[model samples]
Target: MDSDSRLDLEFAYTTYRDCCRDLYSPYYYCRRPLGHDGVHAAGFGSGRVRWEHRPDHAPHLLS
Candidate 1:
């Protein structure tokens, strides 16, 4: 892939990773970045996270 495409892919991947790390669990579906700003906020469910979801990004429970 070209540099631009590669960057886009990397950015997308990073966004997805950050989404799972900052917004929800790895099992949750995370949308693409909402803005061009670096480290843009990620969205998961309910349009926004609830109080209980503040720690949604926390590590999953070991089973």
Candidate 2:
């Protein structure tokens, strides 16, 4: 896979990951427990695995 001209999605990807990471954190839940899920946009069917939405054991997990 290759991008056509200097396309780097690292920023957007990392930002989203960071946001989700925070939201799923225990501290964030303490601040705001209520959260919601979004429908997959590309017709992700029932075959997709449902991930657990609990906080990581530590920040920057698997880094």
Candidate 3:
């Protein structure tokens, strides 16, 4: 895959991992980054993390 596509996949996989590993909200879905009926915040990091998501769900979870 292209670098951009690889980055996107990494972001998606890590978003799922971050939610399961860090987030402890009963409201947020832990299986993966998932949006609520309204919104759910779900991801953060920089450098190696290299990606972040934002609301609608939150981070990736919100959108």
Candidate 4:
């Protein structure tokens, strides 16, 4: 294939890889552990998942 054809093939391959990733393992595939706020601003350093409860809600979590 020519340069343009090769580029098109590479793009197609990347798209297919992303599609498979999203379909099979949308979460926990390449995801790092989230903190209490569920944002990536800062990661928990203790190697443990933590959750913070709202003033009106109870705390819950899974290992």
In order of appearance, the predictions have TM-scores of 0.24, 0.19, 0.25, 0.23
lDDT of 4 by residue, 1-63 (tens): 863454334334443223212111222121222221232111123432222334564322222
Name model 3 segments beyond 4 Å from true.
Answer: 16-63
- TM-score order of candidates, top first: 3, 1, 4, 2
Report every candidate's CA lDDT. 0.38, 0.26, 0.37, 0.28
Overall local distance difference test of candidate 1: 0.38
Q: Tens digits of per-residue lDDT for model 2 on 1-63?
A: 432111123223333334333223323221111232431111023422223444443433212
Candidate number of the best TM-score:
3
How would the candidate models be sorted by lDDT, starting from the highest?
1, 3, 4, 2
After superposition, candidate 1 runs with Cα above 4 Å error? 16-63
Worst 10 residues of 4 by lDDT: 21-30
Report the CA-based lDDT of candidate 3 relative to the real structure: 0.37
Q: Measured by C-alpha RMSD in angstroms, how accurate is candidate 1?
A: 9.4
